[model samples]
Target: MLNDMSENQAGYAFAWNTPKSAINPYLDPPDPVQKSALREVIALYAADNRRHQKPGESLRNAVWDRYFFNADRDPVLREIAQDKLTGQARMARERQRFNPEQTVMDDIHAQPAWIARPLLQRIAFLKNLSRPGPCQRYLCATVRPCLDRLTRVRDDQTGPSIRQMAGHPGLEGLLVLSDMNQNQVKRLSALVAAHMAGRLESACSLLPLDNDVQPEAIRRVWEQLAAEVMRLEVIPPAFEQLKRKRHRRRPVSYDRIPGSLARMICTTWWYRRLWQRRCEWREEQLRAVCLVSRKTSPYISREMALYKREQRRKSLEFFRAHELINEHGDRLEMEAVVRASTSHPVRRRNEMMACLKGLELIAEMRGDRAIFYTLTCPSRFHATLSHGQPNPMWAGTTVRQSSEYLVGVFAAFRKAMHKAGLRWYGIRVAEPHHDGTVHWHLLCFMPPGDCSAITALLRRFAIKEDRQELGKVTEPRFKANAIDSRKGTPTGYIAKYISKNIDGRGLGKHISKETGTSLRDSAEHVTSWASLHRIQQFRFFGIPGRQAWRELRLLAGQVNRQHNGRKAGAPVLADRRLDAVLAAADAGCFATYISRQGGVLVPRRQYLVRTAYELSDVQNKYGDRSRRIYGIWSPLTKERICTHSFKWKRVRKTSGGQISPGRGHLFTPWTRGNNCPHGEKINAHHRIRVQRKEEETIKDFKNEHK
Candidate 1:
């Protein structure tokens, strides 16, 4: 019968199988009360089937047909009219209806009149009869096509609703309604069959929301989804996890003292007693983190001594190799002329000439006054040389190798000047002129006579000797000499070479265009004082004593010879300032002179800033020697090693023309001149006048004393 039953209708059948049975010895059925209830339900279904069946035919339209349609031969339902007589034979064959042996049945059988009276009373109590149980109420509610239509829409929200329906009796309600459909009916039939087979409870346990129902009936599905949405909305603050952090504390007070001083005093008892220690625990923690090194003072000192020894050895080696140091340990002087070219080959000849003239004027004012001057070649000479078109073999080197040719020429000039008692500052080679001739502007510092001699010498070697002519040179004229007067005589030459050249014009034109500064003022700003100070510190060494100067000349010669020997195919240049003559010439451009004792005297605004070498205070008695001077009070106690008699010894008077202990007196405050010794100020003296009476009293006291 279940195989023919629809799923929708199965709900009604299941509804009848409710109400737990009372314990009765005679109740053989597993669910006696439900079985009785099902019998009544089947009777109603059989009546309905009969009404729907066609008239007169077989007992198939009867209650038995709906109750047990699969019963092939039931004698009770087989009777036809007199043939299906409801007599003793059929009564004996059919099962007793509703347990006739029960007391209620016997009572009903015995009191037919009482039953009719009860029925009469129930007919007047319609309200009580209309009251519905929970199951009946759910079934009676109006079913809507909206539910079926909603299930057809594919929505993710629908699945939860379906699961929710299965969770409660709601799934049953949905199944009852949907059972009318063929697919629903098949599913319902399977569920019913499983229940009959005793596996329904276990199968339904695994279903979502604990139900065996259709998917479209849940109410809490949307609510659960909303909760899930809420759960994802706000992310928690994770700054504490993501941030980079470090642990640190206040610096130790020991760090307050500088390393140099602290190292000397750190372990002293007095220092430890005076120092304040705060937060010992934190200090210990920091100490642990720092991992203090082992105190191996002896080892450290040994290592330091070793390092010092190594350093001394390297220094000695360098000095020996380069000859920049001597037995006296003074650096050798390097007098060099630095001629930095300002001319751009692409520029006009007039512009180059102007820049050259301006630079010359600067050198002259700075006391670098060029002994001889000439401007014969045009600036376009390089282009002319290129056009001259020598054969490839003849033109062995490119124009870039101009330094090589110039170095040879400069070397020859240096030798000539040396022979003539003129000093060459350096060679400043310029580009070839429009006439295809390479010309040079020489920097030389010599006497007027020597300068004249050099002009004659130039005529001897120059390509067009007739073209080389000398001219008279004088300092440039200025409206105000205030700035000029402040400069040393040599400072004028310093100012001349340092001037900038622009647009084929000299410093005069540039100074004119500049607002707020005069030509003289501009000229004063350009001083050779700094250069002089630097050169004073410049010392050369490694020259044997007898020919020290000659050795330097040789070095200059070596530099020049290397320049000349360079392969024409290789692009090599010579340093113009390497020539001894050029270096000597440039040295004269210095405004301040350097002494072995005094360091540097650089011109500062109105005065000079002098920094001298601080000598030690250690004194040693020597044959006719003055005492030691100023510096550290601690004496240098090294044992005397050299047996040779000292060439330089300390002396006393300023006029002695000797270095002495009172050399500090020259820098002392007592010197009442522009030169303040030792950077100290002189105090003024005040005179006190004695009145006539006071003088007489003083004289009387003096006479009494006599």
Candidate 2:
């Protein structure tokens, strides 16, 4: 009957020849128990087959015959044998489920010869399997064959050693690799490969490992070494497994390594490189999430924005409640004092614009030329194309790396200009590309004769790498234009950029050419990009440093206070030049300030005055002493003038209803400028003591907390 059935009508069948009692040996009267347990299974199976069978065929008779008959034309007594087989298969599958801890042991046991090997050889095999990249792949591919070979070769026998067979001529420089710890080996291997491949230009570039070498360089070199090692093959399975496990673990900060051993490891080149890569990866992951959230929600959630606003309002209220009192009994609200400083965004922007305008005016008066230049990184540094597709040529370069590259290029240009005896002063504005790579826009003022030389030097350094990508026109890499008086002022050209990066004010309906998004919509992302990368957006070079300028202003304030009510002709400083600089700073005239400070061309030490700093009495939270600006010192007069004459202290506010100091009340003098040396530790101790006191005050605190 089965042979007569069509292929589709004859469903899959299981054969059994054993007695029915054998299917369930523990249960007596197995027929009833087995039938009850398998009734659902048998009915489902019969129904499935019946759906596919001919209409006239009896599904019940077919299932009965199929379960009872054997392949040999013999009557099978066991009716539940198929069910037992199904249950056993499922149990075997459950047993084979993946467990990271057991997988290695199971693999080792599969090769019986490995169990009897010497301890050293067994250890080597396990280490090789645990490592990532080529070593692990090689071990996995030839595990069985290699183990058999090892078992056949005795200690007394002479044969090719595993080390000799595995060694590559290119990696001979790393001969002592096996003896070193994992981090050392990885660092040495990467260094050797980078040197051999000529990826690292000079040995000096790798020194002062923490500071000199950029994280991007480390990331690139390690990636190159990894690629070369695992060329033409998929990533090692062990590495993938370990990577998954690491991702599942809680996030670890790379800012500070806790243990001495870990810090020692971080000192190595490879580890530092890995640290940078990990940081970049984390930032990119976060940025991606934020971008997605912004896309899905057109505007920021009103509740979260309002909550943040409320937090700011409360903080301002708290600050307003306190006053920073100087020794003279003068008091100022902390909130008002801080907000009046240049740290405020609107104030900073206004100051920068004023400075730029002053510089341009000075340049015009001196018959100097104003030139605007735009500098961009190479194409490979960009992670995405203009159309928003991932660039295939990008090697995982990040915005921070691109910004660093631009900075280095500018530094080189500066050095070249200094060597050639060129004089120029300007401001540099770093802004992010639509895809987050950084580019620079510079508005420089130079003598008419030196403008060409400056432009040539900038272009040379900017296009030094991947010069071909610019084709016949090099403007894509570096562009220069003479500031035509008819078009607009140099300050006007850069003012919009400053506004866009800062607060996006007055940029109504303006669209970004790079992303085709509204400038107002993308301004927040641009600001966040600069902040996340810690890139300085606006920097003015070839002028007096801002620190000295601030110190001069402080000195001017002190002078004004001293002569407030006195009949003094003029407030005298240490020298005449110092008085002029003080006046310029007081009037907010940057051009006069720059001229009085020995012009933009003069070196820093030759300036009229400099900032004087003194070491703090107490160490900071990091247990390191830091310098604080105390006064201004005139280089010409060789005289020091103290500006920070009065010490201020922070204290809690007292209301009108609060008790005032009485005759018997004891007053504790403020020491160390009222700054706690170990603020964090003291705060933690106070919290613990308050909690204990609260527990003592309340009897049922523990039960209530639970």
Candidate 3:
């Protein structure tokens, strides 16, 4: 009679044999008490089939269609159904329900009464873990290309920029790629940050631990990442990462105290690296979330227009100081220019012409000093250049090849400036036209020299190297005149070029007004730019960059010795500044400011907010040589090797430049009158005083002197 049984609702039908429990003991399933509601539902459906009639058949997935989805349905009508094959059959059925991209582990919290978590964890973990790590295709094919379009690094610190975060063990989240429709690129970037902050618990909660194997696998990969972070502990603080094996060891600590000094250097290195990594991760986060891009008409800067109006000689003086030029018209060497570019060699000279003003801003900010000069007073020079207009011949060229070619142009331009005696601090950012050809915007610091002469030099050299190497400058290239930066102008000047080549201003803005191809579509139209081009988009030169790491290292050591142990083999406290910065963190987000009042019981506001880098000690080094160190981060060695040197060791005073050793001279980025080295209460540029030094060295020195 069951042979005539009709099909169940979902078009599924099964013939059931006479009750299997009554005939075959080997076919018996577990007792009803052990069966879950889900299982019971299956058992009842099978019994329904058996009573209906066909022999040697059982109820199929139609039961789930009937009961698992409809909570009102009850399945325990009779106890005659016992199918041992139910488990495998149910799994197979579940697998068929979702698309291949989804996993059964996704519904862990959805059905607590149906399947206990332990059972779910066991079964789901095994199945997903056995699956290969998330598809690498989305990482390479979709996300990377998009990132290459979006991320552009300005050369400031040695930390990894958003562009370089890829391939870091901290960024393994890219492995668990979701479909394109899911907007997984943003999630992948966040996951990388999560790993960097060591937020394992947060990661565990946000991602599916049992089903999506890739996230779990990504966490495991970073054990090696932690090892790399730990390995940097050997490098001295302040110095860039070791880019290559140095031919001979350059002592990071030149101290004579030996073991005590070595311990200090090692400890400082560890804290510094930790801070560097943290800062870099923070910068990456900033770029990922806050970087603003716009597609308004070409930037209109009155400062740039003013720069164009200057006489040729006047414009030349902006980059090369008038005092340094020779009577014979020979330009000062690169060293003089580099020195002059670094805050004009003395506090007396304040006019920083061109985009070079940003260099000072970079220095003061990097040294953890407060930014007193508003973006309003910026005196900078901006210029734009194009390689060729709508050239189809270079359409297929990759970003790497184009970057190499640009390097040649850069070298030629640098040589021309060196020959012509121009030392400018500026940034060069390349933007691709809709056609995929490249154009460059340079924010430079050109003195009040002959604007015509400066323009001539740029025009002459822009194509010089390309002509030299390729044996022909067949393509036409155009160089725009340099413009000076001013109020509201310098702020928008180079920043526009350096920002992501995006379309809409940002999320909350008037996106409807945005015209032209979108930033994303533009990104997709071009070949992978960042993946192939390793060069920084913006560059700085001859600017007061960093306090010599050597100086900072000594300070860190001194602080450690005093707080912990001054004797050899004795334990020392971690860096006080780093401790403050770390302690200032609320949750995983690092503090943008810290109190400076020192043990003062004032409100947090009274403590005075200071920047991340500024949270460190800077006082007492008031007049010291805050030389700029240039370098690159090596992924292979995980080191940032310092490349600049003291070629003019004799020309520049070397040792006495050490900031007077004791108190009343501590200079932080926030320290006022930082430019005026004179201890006399003098120039308005001089900030009055810094918070008293945390060290007792001043009193000791005074006592010893007396």
User: Against the true structure, whose TM-score is highest?
Assistant: 2
Give the whole-model CA lDDT for all candidates, comma-separated: 0.29, 0.57, 0.33
lDDT (Cα) of model 2: 0.57
- Number of residue pairs clashing in candidate 2, backbone atoms closer than 3 angstroms, sequence gap of 3 or more or interchain: 0
Note each model's CA RMSD in angstroms.
Answer: 46.5, 23.4, 25.6
lDDT of 1 by residue, 415-496 (tens): 7867876543321323222212233434333334455566666544443322322222211100111123244432243223
Q: Kindly give the stretch of ten consecutive residues in candidate 3 with the minimal lDDT sum.
A: 373-382
Q: 299 in model 2: Cα distance from truth in Å? A: 16
lDDT preference between candidates 1 and 2, better one: 2
Error in Å for residue 121 of model 1: 99
What is the C-alpha lDDT profile of model 3 across 645-672, one tens digit per residue? 1111111121553323453123233211
lDDT of 2 by residue, 1-706 (tens): 6565444344545334322434566765545445565798899999988787865367666776798655445435343666678898786667656433233345555542313232235346566664555434333433333333333322112123323422555444233332334465565546544443453334235546566665445444444433433331213212332222434554432222112112222224334433333333434432222221222211122222343456557978877765555444444445655566676567778888888987887898788999999999998776445643334456545567788899899889888988998879889999877666789999999999988888888888989999877789998788998999899898898888888887777786898776666777666666655655678999998788877877666555544533446444464553566777888888888889988888776788898889877766555434334567656777676656655544555445677622234521232222212111111011121121111222132223122222
> Which 10 consecutive residues of model 2 have the lowest summed lDDT?
674-683
Q: Arrange candidates by lDDT, highest first: which order?
A: 2, 3, 1
Better of 1 and 3 by TM-score: 3
